[model samples]
Target chain A: MKQRLVSPVRMVWLLGALLIVCILASFTLGHYPVPLGQLLGILGSRLGLPIEVSWTPQMETAVWNIRLPRVLMSVLVGACLAGAGASYQGIFQNPMASPDILGASAGAGFGAALSILIGLSSVGIMVAAFAASLATVALVFTVSRHAKGDRVLGLVLSGIMVSSLFQSATSFIKLVADPNNKLPQITYWLMGSLSGAKWSEIGFILPPMLAGLIPLLLMRWQLNVVTMGDDEARAMGVNAPRIRLWTVLCSTLVTAAAVSVSGMIGWVGLVIPHMTRRLLGADYRCLMPGSMLGGGIFLLVVDNVSRNATTAGIPIGILTAFIGAPFFLWLITGKGDHYEH
Target chain B: MSIEVSHLSFSYGQRQVLHDISFQVRQGEFLSILGPNGVGKSTLFRCVLGLLSGYTGQVLIHGTDARSFSVREAAKHIAYIPQSSRPIFNYSVSNIVLMGRSGSLSTFQTPSKADEERCAWALEKVGIPHLARRCYHRLSGGEQQLVLIARALVQDAPILMLDEPTANLDFGNQLLVLEQAKSLTRDGYTVIQTTHHPEQSYLFSDRILALQNGRILTQGAPSQVLTEQTMAQLYGAAVTVVSLYQDKVRVCVPKHITIQEEAK
Candidate 1:
């Protein structure tokens, strides 16, 4: 029971260093490879700093225009999803709870697909996806409010129903979409990619992501009380219902924002928090930041593999499942007893 | 009085669960509520904790109406130890104990040094400082219950309400937990506990209240309230009360059934 892992402080440093390395490696090794020095030089030039190195326009474009934004997006989206997932799991007091448990991903997927079908602009698609995700969560909340017996179970059950409803809607959109024109685009989007990640998109995602993340980070200690169950939390002087509502709201917002940008990147949200918990015990004060850093590093590595491992870049969503599924299997089977207690 | 409930009644939809229940607990007094299943002992605890609303009468904590108390305000006066259940996540024992300080801490603030000291003190008081760093869910049922009691102690509440504190424990652990609870009254903590064992009530409680069908069948000192007739009527089984230890200690034993014994 007292088997020691790395201390939490050192764990944070390790993950942070790994994230930095992944970011730098992702910048240096892409389809159009830029050397590390030139990559740094190009970054410095863009930041209006004096650096003595000759860098070509193509290297600058690849480093600044394409790879940097994609890498940053992956980090933010990964962190956002992981943070949301951890919060959801704590609030529900269920280890299996994830960011997509309440239909946010499904709703965003349907919105993105519908926008593609209707030929909306990229901004419009993102906005539509965001709005749809929020709407779907609101619907789930309304439905679960009317449900009797075990409020958390009610929310989860309602989430399943609403997710299926949105999933069918997405399927219908795909079916009716123009096969040659919109179909491939919709399919690729559903599979999820960071290929289209742009610097402008960061502006759109950063605010909501921070808005959702900051509150959860601040309330991490209170979340421990929440996991003790509602009646117990209440008796301990924590307003379980109010804290739960805020948690749900923040998690849904962050999750929807991430999905809208990254197109249904799965597994990172569900797996990263569990991985962090194994290393750090289930104290949310450590778990929240640990999961955030772990998730960022995880996706950075996955995104790096997706882009560099193949001539034609693999979609990140596919790679996440490929890596995450096996890892999850090992987690549940290998260390299952640790989690069960 | 540390806690008082007067004519408190509660219902779920059309069916009533607690009917005209009244009780008063003084400072440092140990009151054990004895009841069979479905007799609303838990419901009464909830009412006193202000977790239930729309009840018929009043619950007064330190002479103030309980209905007006916020969750934090209630926590200041009363700490509750629920029956132990396994948590989903494996939190460290220290973190689990630290959660008791949540009522006093602000929403965004972490536990201060003083608060941590109090948590450590509570753990030491419960005699489980060795288990402080162990994962809470990894502990035994008795150990988990002890941690919960330590959590209640950290809350620094005057009145402690425990619902079946020894329900799932082994015989030794049951005695250990009950002994700990009984000792708290000596430290100026008013304890209200619901228990199934009449002998435990007889041994540990200064006052005993026997509840059946949401009503108090009898309420007084343990020797007067816990009689063979009331025990039989409460559980619908014939029983005999016997005294031992120079007629100071009382115990209840079931009367043997002639038919069942012959079949056996």
Candidate 2:
């Protein structure tokens, strides 16, 4: 079927422009608002520009210290998670595959909770989460390697088993944690938030995120060949297993990095890629970048609503589901057979 | 020989699927492999294509051992059209055809503009230029088979291996797909295919290799290899072979249906 949607090129430009607008508008939101001009002036001053500081110190602090890191974290985490999700979906040949399909998010959540109970520093918690996430994926692979039948199905099943294992471990930690301090912290962390965004945390996730994202972006075309299935891939001279390994490694790296910092922001990874596919079609050359931009825009808008919709900021994880589910439903049911082909 | 398999044998764990199968296809020849289900036709193709590495024998493609070649090098020697199945994602027809150029691309490389134009040319050559922008999964069974042929054509290999290209197609589409494959042999392409219909081999193939239980039951020209007794032994059914068009065409008709009708 010929898709009548906006062309892939223009849709990419549209998503990019929308992401920029959302990022700018997010700076204007929150408990302490920074107007657009002062935001630009603050950015210019930071960039060694000759713009005068006509705004107050609090606006500067809000734009530079508070909002900048949080905005960047949201965009990066959003892009990484959604990009990972899209890659996972392609490599696994399952539309239901997501960034968290291989237990990364659950393992990271457990790691963060365990560290919170141990009273570790925030950086330690991030490191612990990252390690635990990777460990979970490694364990899944080892387990699947031993299992018989289809390797992809084996990996997916092992992912489910291991993810639930970690989920129960986190629950046990929650049960034994100190109710007043560690309990609330763990619970809030599990719910997910970008409120604690810091420059150091950004630095920590950046290298791994770039390491993960750059390869995925570069290998997007190969991802298309891989979706034709393993036997077909091998016959066509695209090394399916090697491509699958690299894809899993890179996507897992990105997922682990995003989850370590952002707690458990869930729906953006799973839903944003599908939404981008609806708009841009299933070509990964476009879908990869499209998911990144669509995810950044989606999560940025959700984060804006999270921090600004109420006097007490809502946790982003909650807002993502609240907003993401309905919007995704509308995209699916409202459209006339967008995915039917 | 364009392709040769020497004493190729494969097994899964304790059970062997293909047992010392041997065959050859000469240059510009259309060879049809006929067999029933579970006869290891697909396993043989996989062995030849290097998808199965544990097989015991050598598959030489144009004097080079098929196993010695890397995946890309294998693609240069042979193009494959796998059985048509619905893919998870609905890729555009042009995009699916474009993937045939992937053997020439590096790990991080995409199909260039030249590759895209070649993809278009292959589409035109396959007579599916009108469906270039259509979704692959939305096409009819025959149309999907043609799209896959277009993809194989884009690979630009001298030898083509098709695994039951007409399995799920209607009668007209079956003839259409077989016609396309048969015509390619005229253009100096070595085409090897597997089929369930014995009559199709009679009509289109230069040689027939019949398999029974992973063993070569018979091989040669269709007339000699497709007698009533051989057909019955191969498929374990009562059948009769008859000539048509003043002995120019031959067909196998199962006798059980007529006997049951006469009894009724």
Best by DockQ: 2
CA error at residue A4 for candidate 2, angstroms: 2.5
Per-residue lDDT of candidate 1, residues A1-341 (tens digit): 34656776577788888889888888767668888888888888789998876988877887788888999999999999899999999998888988999999999999999999999999988999898999999999999999999899999999999999999999998899999989998888889888879988999988999999999999999999999898898899999999999999999989999999899899999999999988776888888988999989888889999988998999999999999999999999885435321
User: Could you give candidate 2's per-residue lDDT for residues A76-122 as a string of tens digits?
Assistant: 99999899999999999998899999999999999999999999999
- Candidate 1 reference-contact recovery: 0.71
| TM-score, candidate number 2 | 0.96
Candidate 1 clashing pairs, residues 3+ apart or interchain: none
lDDT of 2: 0.89
How does each model score on TM-score? 0.96, 0.96
TM-score of chain A of 1: 0.96
Ten-residue region with minimum lDDT total, candidate 2 chain A: A332-341
lDDT of 2 by residue, B84-178 (tens): 85778768888899889998899899899999999898888778889888888778999999989888888889999999998899999999999
Candidate 2 is graded, for docking, as medium
